[model samples]
Target chain A: MITLNDLTQISETEWEIPQSFRSDMRGPVRIFATRELLDHVLTDKSLEQAVNATTLPGLVGAVTVMPDMHQGYGFPIGGVAATEFPQGVISPGAIGYDINCGVRLLGSQIDFETAKPHLDILATRLNQYCPSGVGKDGMVKVSIPELDQVLRDGTKWALKNGYATKADLARTEEGGAFKGADPRKVSERAKKRGKSQIGSLGAGNHFVEVDLVQDVFDEEAASIMGLKKGHLAVQIHTGSRGLGHQVCTDYVREFQSAVRRYDIQLPDRELVCAPMDSPEGAAYLGAMRSAANFAFVNRQLLAHAARRAFEETFAGKTKNWHLHQVYDITHNMGKIEVHEIQGERIKVCVHRKGATRAFGPGAPGLPPEYQKIGQPVLVPGSMGTSSWVLVGTEDSMMRSFGSSCHGAGRMMSRSKAKKKFHGDMLRLELGDRGIHIRAGSMKGLAEEAPDAYKDVNAVVETVSQAGIARKVARLKPLAVIKG
Target chain B: MPFEEISHTADWSIRVWADDLRGLLAESAQGMWMLTGTEQAEGPRVSREISLEAYDAESLLVVFLEELLYLSEFEKIVFDGFSDLVIEGEKISGIMEGSALRSMEKEIKAVTFHNLAIHESERGLEVEIVFDV
Candidate 1:
């Protein structure tokens, strides 16, 4: 286990665990957190997991973790690692089970004050319109062949099916589709699990929230993205569902032998990997991209559902009720990109698990409207708390591989949270504060209580102070829908 | 031996123990179901056979639990109990029986191999499994 004393503090918001600490590590681990947040991280194995991540062969630069870091299986949540392309290894565990699991923000012209009267019904409609909960099916079912198209085309399928708009695609990461996603590389079992899950929200921390843009810090940037203070916006937090989970499971299982075949040594079995140039690596990349594409459509369909809910609640009453795409970002993903590492520019596969890509201004692939600002980073807080909108900085591009914090990292266990807070009481508490809540399972609600997570404000502060991300706006929840 | 839910910062974890490797695997499966607050529906009992091969005991444990997880995910069926579990040289076969999952309070996303190791203790065999929920 790693302790704070072993870390060399670079700044109030940054710390480092040198490669010398572990002889097997190929690189050092850079952490973005204040002493207060680092104290919380030390209580768990988040730092140790980050150190384990450093051992990935061909690791370029330092393995950086966001302030929301929390122990999660092999690689800690909010961790980011970049490995040399086509040579370094890609570990499925490093990318996470929920491939392309991410957040989507939709800005609206409807002001919250004017929409307050319709809040309760909007929450109910969102829950009803968006299929959710365990064993829930999507709004539309596709045949196996059609599911392949969904995987191959991603948001293109959504656009063709009339579920998305051109602007939605333009504003999405990679334009809402990952190229080279060959469905043949995906497993039949993963396909079966994904076929029925498209457009559906599976349980466990996934939710749809209605928020009021409470404050805008960077007005020029916020205005360009169509975000205005006091206006209502929607946040959808979900991922590729069972298909992605199965893909990771299948690869993790298969890679067990691949590690032996490659003669690689690992501290944990979950981090099993193969050289990116190997057949196994090529297959996983193809299949992982397929899963990622599926997740893009998953969120797009949910966004379509949210739009419907918005229309039903505000159309007849207000003329300015339509919602526009702000941005969509995938937090749990591995993408091949070129970044500067110690004054050297080279290509690397950046693995971001519970970390969002926060590309700074002038970065390639961003929509024209955002070229002057930066890629919008959506950070959702625990239910009934504040969420944030941040943008990547040039410093982030240099120091953190263009990644930032994902959310309020969990500080307590679900079992402990459940034992400490009652779901029914939580509902009343949020209700007393004027936030409407609709949840499939009350027991599950207790497990995600606000107290279970660290202070999101503190997390945002650390990233902002560290020059990794800059705050644009803060949002307060008015209603939430959870599976 | 027995199984118990343990504290994991962000996900579900269970520490399972038994008299042997096979018992440990069975208990881990049961313990996972318990953690999800899963309830089986009243229906004709369903039985399924599972056969898996891995490189070691740890991999075997992951595959066994993953098979069960896949069933629950793909078919909405939870194999509450296992019988005739035989483990031999990284090859395990067993019979799982349960009813349709009526409802599940929480859904476990995936079974992870993080720090997963099956160990022999003076009392018996033990393992700690972390789950991505």
Candidate 2:
């Protein structure tokens, strides 16, 4: 029960929970939110979890939380923590069960007006091509050895299998593949789960939407990313599926003993972790990276499916029906990087649970065209709302370790949403608003009602005012496919 | 029913109480099935054996439920009840009887150990489990 009075206001958009707030905290907790949003945050245990996160061994600087922060199982969603490189601890719960759960944006040159008449057909085609919902197998199934290749090669496997192009890989994070993924470290059960779900969008908040770029704030940055107002774009939201879940489950369970053996005490069992240099930590990292790579390939395959749908619906009618990759970014991930902390260049592992990596201009990993503009951060809004395209700032690197808010975080419980809104009613309401809706289950749709989430506009405003990220474009949903 | 859904800001939570550990686990499973809106196909009854061991009761509970989840996802089966149940020390062995799942409304990602603890109440045993959906 941390209240607003317990925090020290740093500025209009910044607040701090001093390390003195708790005896065990290794560092302070820095929060980015407006006064209004902070009131919503106070109703949950998000701040308490942030304080608990500060107790992790080898923590550096302050634990940072974005405006979209909400109560999660272990680490509060929208929280970020950087720990001293090899000596710090990595908690599986901090990075979340959905390893590399992220968003992919593909911009097209076709005008929305030209494609308006076929939106219904496009939704059906996309739903048919992209496998979604619970217990659903993907479009492609692979043998164990083939799955191993996918674990190691990621989007490179997609390229080799004719599912992706060279340009698409360039626009993805870490080239849509992470190094040091050893399949041997992953469990056989995890492998089996990965085999059949290579390209699936599992239910519970995962979706693919057709959006129209309604406005562009940064003309230069938007042009570099191929985003033009009045044109159509597609956003794919999913992750590594059961493979990632089992990997996290296996590690979280195993680390319960590792924490005890290493003499590390935590306030929460879900936050169990091990030293990055220890055998247990190394093994989990290997397995986690493999699951992350599987996710990258998963998104690539979905993008391929999306492209097929686009071509089928728009081809012959429009001159350019192909969807070009804008950017793909993962929110739930831990990456090893070097940062300047307290005037010292220190290597650290940054854990971003429900935060996006928003690398600013001149960052090392950006494609050549994006060097001057910065990395594209796609923030998809709740169903039938406006999504945002933002870019990282140098202030983000300096203040928040190059991270930004993920989305309009959940403000209400799923059960509450279900009780207040009927799925069929919601669909009809959205349809009245001109947004075509296709979902696996109506009840599932009700659980994700728009009112269940915080306002995305306010979230974007908070981060923008905090100087971590800047707006590039705004997108309005035309059609939504939910699992 | 000995179990009911609890309000969680982000994910599903359920509170269950039973006369003992075995009943608690069974009720938890039933609660989970209800949360997912799982339906069974019409067919002959099927029975499968489940045996698992863990370091403690909480761990055993998680392991047991996760086994059911794995079976439901991969083997496409859902258990309705358990028989010949035995809980000795850290090991539990039982027979699960159910039918093939006709359909499931949603997906439960994993069983979380967030503040998971089985407590001893005057009635018997009670516990709260949070699930990542």
Candidate 3:
């Protein structure tokens, strides 16, 4: 176990566990957290896992941990690592089982105060339109051939089917589609799961939240993103559902032998990986990108369902009831990006698990309107707390590979949370605060109680203080729908 | 009880042990059922054949549980017990009996191989497994 004393304090908001701390490590571990926030993670094994991540072959620079870091299966959640492209390995576990699990924010012109009286009905409509809960089938069950198109075209299929708009795709990450997606590389079982779960939200901490833009810190940036203060916005948080999980499962199991064949030694079996150029690695990359594209379409379909609910509730109430796309960002993914490493421009595979990419201003591939402002980073807090909208900074590119914290990391176990809080009581309590709660199961709700996580405000403060991301707006949740 | 839920900050995990590999697999499956709040219906008793192979005991354990999870997800069936169990080298063949799932409280993403190891203990075999939720 690592102690606080082992870390060298770099600043009030930064700390470092040098490479010399471990014998087999190829790089150091840099952590962004205030001393007070550091104490929360010290109670868990997140730091140890981050240290283990430093041992991955072809690791360059350092492994970075955000303020919301928590212990996950292999690589610590809220961790980021980059490896030399085509030479370094890609671990399925590092990208997470959910594949492209991410968040989508839609800015609306509906004023919260003007719509408060009908918020309850809005919550009900959202719950009905967005299919959520354990093992729930999606709204549309595509045939096998059509499912392959989903894997191949992503949001393009949605656009052709009238489930998406051109502007929506323009604001999404990678235009809501990934290149080189080969459905042939995906397993039949995964395809089966994908056909049934394309537009549904799986349970366990996933939610569709309605938030109020209570405060705006950067007026110009917020305006460009169409986030006006005192207006309403909807946030959809989910992923590829069962399909992505199966794809990762198949590859992680196959890589167990790939490691031995390539003479790669890893501390944990979950971190099993293969060189990007190897046959196994190429197969995984193809399958993973296919799953990733499926995830993009999954979110696009849900966004369609959300818009239906919105139109039902506020179409006639407001002059313009439609919601505009602000941004869509994936937290768990492996992207090939070029950055300045050791003063040399190098292409690398940046793996972010429970971390969001926050590209700074003028970064290539950014939309025209956002090129001067920077990429929008959506950080949703637990129910009964405030969510933050931040933008990437130039310093983020140099310090943490242009990544930021994802959310207020869990600090308590689910079983313990259920034992400590009553789900029905928590719902009633939040309802009393003007926040409506719609949940499938009360027991599941207990596991996501507000007290079960760290303070998200503190998390954003750390990243901002560390110069990795800058705050743009603060959102307060008015209605939360959980599965 | 041969299994118990362990404290994990971000995922579901359990520490399971029994006298042998077969016992360990059975106990782990039962433990997983408990973690997901999976309850079996009292309508009927059905049986299904199970066969698997892996490189080692730990991988075998993950593969076996994954088989059960896949069945529950696709076939809407949950196993209650294993009979005619056989473990030869890295292969395990058996017959599992159970009824359809009555209810499930959680969605377990996958059975993971995170630091997985089946080792010896005072009673016999012991291992810890983590599930992504």
Ranking by lDDT: 2, 1, 3
DockQ, every prediction: 0.88, 0.87, 0.90
Best by DockQ: 3
lDDT of 2 by residue, A118-237 (tens): 999999999999999988898897999999999988899999999999999999999999998888889999999989888988888999999999999999999999999999999999
The lDDT of each candidate is: 0.93, 0.93, 0.92
What proportion of true contacts does candidate 1 retain?
A: 0.97
lDDT by residue for model 3 over A1-483, one digit each (tens)? Answer: 899899999999999999999898899999999999899889999999999888888888999999999999999999999999999999999999999999999999999877899999999999998899998999897999999999989899999999999999999988988887889989999999888888998898888999999999999999999999999999999998999999999999999999999999888899999999998988888888889889889888888998999899988788988989999889999998999987999899999999999999998878999999899999999878999999999999999999999999999999899999999999999999999999999999999998999999999999999999999999999999888
Segments in model 3 whose C-alpha atoms lie over 4 Å from true places: none
Off by over 4 Å in 2: none
Candidate 1 lDDT over residue span B1-133, tens digit each: 3988889998999988899888888888889889888888998999888789987898888888888877886788888667676788999887778789877788778889999988888659999999999
> At residue A36, what lDDT does model 2 achieve?
97
- lDDT (Cα, 0-100) at B86 in candidate 3: 89
Per-residue lDDT tens digits for candidate 1, residues A109-224, read 99877899999999999999999998888888899999999989999999999999999999999999999898999999999989888899888899999999999999999999
Residue A483 C-alpha lDDT in model 3:
86
